[model samples]
Target: MTFPSGGRVPEPYGQSSGANLADILERVLDKGLVIAGDIRINLLDIELLTIKLRLIVASVDKAKEMGIDWWETDPALSSRAHRDELARENAELRAHLAELERGRGQEDPSLERGRVSEEPS
Candidate 1:
């Protein structure tokens, strides 16, 4: 396909039509594949932000062999840890809310009266 910029882009599925799909899959799964790219945002010749993205495609066993299994231990991905963290956070927020309510409840009426007395009658 020809782009507006006159650059020729190959078809998505046609690229591997001549090659053996099984051979490509075996090679990729065995050695793994790393696709990396950088995205930049520029405003009026000034670079505002830059983002780097990296992706790895491999079999589950291969990925684990590479020591890249963070999802296994991530609290959000683990049911027990997720529930524990949520419960702890909920208890803390409840405690903080109770403390604030207690402080408001203990407010001195004399302080309000003093402020009222200082105002013009």
Candidate 2:
């Protein structure tokens, strides 16, 4: 099946054939098992992923040209901005708790959504 993102939605478990099953099993069980290597799994609960490799390699000039500030703005990453954000978040949490204590029924703040836009292109 084709997903909305136009990526192939592979057959669900037990729907695909023997070759597909073999491929899946090999990929899961024999990862890093090439050239005299071996892979081990618990098969109890899901094997806790030991390490996740996330490689993002770009030429410095190209990255600078694109204004791609790697790790600086990502929330999951630990940076000074993240720490500052945590501090701000703590302050906001305190403010929100104070507001709740003061008993303002939390209806989400609404902005003007009356206007509709016409497609230009």
Candidate 3:
């Protein structure tokens, strides 16, 4: 541990650096990390295909801080989104039914009398 300068030498690749896997992961999640890459395939000097890939790794809080909360509004991922979607659909259906009823009433004067036309047994 002694050096020529009479000071302790820093350990090489040792725990003293405090760079363990857990520590690295915690830092990554706290600060967030983005990996971006592009792959291109060319034939006869012409670009045929290109693929762009982006990946981000972070904690939920960090992701929200970065304004990346698509999961919250995605119906497949969020119950609240699914409920909202259902409510919207229900409202649309109700509106359509009311419109149809109004159209039918205009065509049949008996419908405006509020009389239920009983069907034959």
**TM-score top scorer:** 3
TM-score of each: 0.47, 0.32, 0.71
lDDT of 3: 0.90
lDDT of 1 by residue, 1-121 (tens): 6899999987688677657787888889988999999999999999999999999999878999999887765788888778877899999999999999999768899987887899997
Model 3 — TM-score against the truth?
Answer: 0.71
Per candidate, the number of residue pairs that clash is 0, 0, 0
Model 3, range 1-121, lDDT digits (tens) per residue?
8988899876777675565778999999999999999999999999999999999999999999999999998999999999999999999999999999988867766764445555444
Poorly placed runs, candidate 3 (over 4 Å): 1-19, 108-121
Write down the worst ten-residue block by lDDT for model 3. 112-121
Reference-based TM-score, model 1: 0.47
Candidate 1, overall lDDT? 0.88
